[model samples]
Target: MADSLGIRVFFIKGPASVLQGLRQAKLSADVDVFVDPARLDELLQALRERGWHDRPVDPDSRTFPKHSVTVHHSEWPCCIDVHFRFPGMEKPPRVCFESLWVNTETIALAGQQMRIPARELGVLFLALHALREPLLPACRQELDYLGELARREGLSEGLLGLAGTTDALAAVRPFLEDLLPKTTSFVWPEASVEWRNRVASHEPGSARVLAILHATWRVKPRMLWGALFPPPEVFLGTNIYADMSMAGRLRQHRARWARFLRAMPRLVRDLRGLKSSGD
Candidate 1:
């Protein structure tokens, strides 16, 4: 349907797209794809008709942009994460989707022609992991693969140039340096204390609420109130209590309240830990 509608789609960020045919590449549980944002509604409808159902979107998740969705079909039992933008950049890169689309490469996969980021842009896409979470072992492994590809293809200069243009050189530098022969196991570079604090401050849920309260309480006092008492439909859906008798609704509310009370101790502990961490 997307092809019929003239919407461009490209595979990205999973084993098939990033690690295809690499001996060290681990299999990803699901496939990731990016599509034209304007065609999102049409894509969603098409997927639904094909037995894919939408998963709830967590409004506070900072990991993915707002124009992203996950859908699953029972027949395949693997999720398809659809994105209109790349993940985990503190801000959007200077590079844009139009340029990426213009440079995509075609590849044969399972008897179908699929599109992916061209070599230079592909390295940039994988480098996002370093910026997001450089400490993770999986991310380091990906960097290793990227570095090997760059050297083998004589793309070192091109990759560095692209990274510089995208304002991602700072994140890409350490990984490139790791490619140099070394005697030691790669020690994860420590993010500066200020950087760590900033990342933590922007974390979703309660941390975000606190930051908003601190920065704009007088101008938008409603933020705090909304955080504390979000509409039940956000979680329970509009029809949660629709068909229930008064007695049943009352029982459901009581049960929910009991669960909240039971979770209070853990919640308090988490809050204390956050405070201690200076976030």
Candidate 2:
């Protein structure tokens, strides 16, 4: 559909890796396609016209600078994640896609020709994506897999050039430290607000905390209220409670509140530490 609209689209993340023979065992949770930022709405409308619907989400969650929008159909098991920009890449969305498009090559998948990032870019993005949640067991395994890829393909300075242009050098540095020149050590920069939020936790609570942290003095009270009593849609949109009954959804919200309360102290400490550093 996007192709008919003159939009250039390409796969990314898990599907891209699988299509390029980079990782056979990796499974895609959804179909992730990177589309031209300029035509994102047209592509989204096309999907909607075909019975795909956006996830039930609050307005704040749909704000700009977000990487992707997820749409789902009742009959499909996995959602379609349409991305206009990628997280951890600080370059303008159009510019970043343009840089990456240059390195993309055609591949055959599902009986159709598709474009995916080159092997080197694939390995780099794998590290960048895994490093988002460095402590998770799955993320740890991904980092380990990245090490295997690096060893097999060998490192390249050109990968560093791509990382540099996208301002993701500091984010992917810990994984690729040995790729750096030996004479001068690389210094890590401060982590961005979004990065810290991702690291703090993958919960709406983290977004609430961040909203409070960045809220002005005058709006702090309103933000505090919002944090305490977020819209029910915020909790309803999650897969955990999507199929649950009303009572079950309420229970899930209660459970989330308890977890959020328990995690607040540690989250504060982590965010404070991140204020002065980056991972």
lDDT against the true structure, per candidate, is 0.59, 0.74
TM-score of each model, in listed order: 0.62, 0.86
Model 2 lDDT at residue 175: 77
Q: Can you write out model 1's per-residue Cα lDDT over 1-279, one digit (the tens) per residue?
A: 577768888887665544443325566777788887667778888889988977654354322235467787778857888877664322252244565677688888867888887777777777664445554677667667777776787776676555545444544557556553466444443443223433343223434334453444474555555445544433433232243556755665666557566766654665567679765
Report the alpha-carbon TM-score of model 1 versus the true structure: 0.62
* Candidate 2 TM-score versus the reference: 0.86
Q: What is candidate 2's lDDT per residue for 1-279, written digit by digit as tens?
A: 766788898888776686555565766788888888888899999999999999866545412236888899988899888988777777789888888888788888878888888887887777878887888898888787777667666755766777887777767777777655577566676656666566565543765676567667898887677666666666656762463667876787688889888877777776667576643
Q: Which ten residues in a row have the lowest lDDT in candidate 1?
A: 194-203
Top TM-score prediction, candidate number: 2
**Model 2: residues with Cα > 4 Å off, grouped in runs:** 19-21, 61-65, 184-189, 202-204, 240-249, 275-279
C-alpha root-mean-square deviation, candidate 1: 7.0
Q: Global CA lDDT of candidate 2, please?
A: 0.74
